[model samples]
Target chain A: MQFVRAIVRPEKKDEVLENLSSGGFNAATVVDVVGRGKQKGIRMGDIYYDEIPKTLILVAIEDADTDKIVDIILRTAKTGTDGNFGDGKIFISPVEEAYTISKGTKGL
Target chain B: MKEIMAIVRMKRTGATKRALIEAGVAGFTAFKVTGRGKLLDHSEINVPCKEKLMGMAASDVIDRKESEEQVVTFLDDKRMFPRRMFTILAYDEDVPRIIEAIIKANRTERGAGDGKIFVTPVNNAVRVRTGESGDAAIW
Candidate 1:
């Protein structure tokens, strides 16, 4: 199994979730987080905001399905044609074990 | 690559950020979280809050010393405290530096709740903009 975590702008959260669901990867955990990327944060009117609000979407899926899911996220979460700073990044991590709570079954 | 996750006191976030930057880390994500440690105080758990509440009326509970004690016990039993978690992705060679930076910034000589640092292996990272992967992606 693989754990995929994507951090995207708050405004693009819904669109990304919808696309992921339509792609048949439904189970996800979403969180509101504040952070910055390579560009650090943004400035407006002489004010520097270091922490920008972003939505973190987490999903656990079969290893084979990783590419498809990454594609779905990248396509839906991108801000524009070439993309911009703060467009967000996707990380893939190996999942050692997974279990279904209600069913008491193991694995993804 | 490794993912360094550090859970530290909320008040120490600024120090941690500066430390990470000075250590040459490019970016990281932080979240406000509530969590508790495994070491539970047996003394506080012995006196249940419900029994204390039963000893006094609801209105008088506010002014009584026993009520204040009860509130403390309740909080001790629940034990959850606000913490800031920083998640940083870095190359294998950078992991040690990042971990050291986090520890130096957040560690207190006091007891538990100084927080923890977990290092996990990352299979891959992708930069959405340029379609770069691996080290190129993280930097």
Candidate 2:
């Protein structure tokens, strides 16, 4: 199994999640975080911030579902029409194992 | 000045997050992140290190900018299973509550294998559909 981490602009978080849930991949985890991407943070007016808040969406999927899941995330989080800074980013990683606590079983 | 992020340890994060929301947080993002700090198998160097794709997203009103900081909360589920990692992002106002709830959910004492929480600042946000501001766009 493969785990996908989508680091996207905070604004696009909802849209992404909505898409994921509707796309049949509703089982996952959500966390709020702060970090920067290639843009290395953002600048507004006279203010310069170092860290940018981002949403990390975590989901474990079958090896075959990896490509489609990533595609959906990108499509949902990508800039739609209005220009926006910090569009966000997504990363894929390996999950050593997964478990359902109530069941006390391991899924890898 | 620093990026805000969270590293939480728990199983079935979907449930933990639902609990946090009830505890009071605007909203959050999560990644399938993986990592080991204490019991991390330090024996292997290039042992194909595994890590979860962990991160979080937060936005604030233009006036409440100073409140942004790295929010860290730890959660623990003692079952002798593979440890899970998560990163949380939220405004400083809700850190205490989130931590409290996370601690409660993990069922940890002062400090166990639960996890840690951190926070940081966000640069800017704009609605992709209507060009709304970050706070307005996301929240």
Best-fitting candidate, scored by TM-score: 1
Q: How does model 1 fare in lDDT?
A: 0.73
Q: lDDT tens string, model 1, A1-108?
A: 787989999899878877777687755556688898777699888988889999887677788999999999999999879999998999998754443322223444
Model 2 CA deviation exceeding 4 Å by range: A81-85, B1-139
The collision pairs in model 1 are none
lDDT of 2: 0.54
B126, model 1: CA deviation in Å?
0.7
Interface RMSD, candidate 1? Answer: 12.2
lDDT of 1 by residue, B1-139 (tens): 8887666788999999999989998699998865544334454443453455555547745567776666666544233467787888888888767766776777664434566665667889999999999889998
| Every candidate's lDDT | 0.73, 0.54
Task: Give a tens-digit lDDT track for model 2, residues B17-120.
Answer: 77777886646666545432222223232122211101222343353323222111121111122345544545446555665565556553323334444333
Clash statistics: count for each candidate: 0, 47
- State candidate 2's TM-score: 0.44
- Chain B TM-scores per candidate, in order, are 0.77, 0.50
Best by lDDT: 1
Candidate 1 runs further than 4 Å off: A1-108, B41-68, B74-77
* TM-scores for every predicted model: 0.49, 0.44
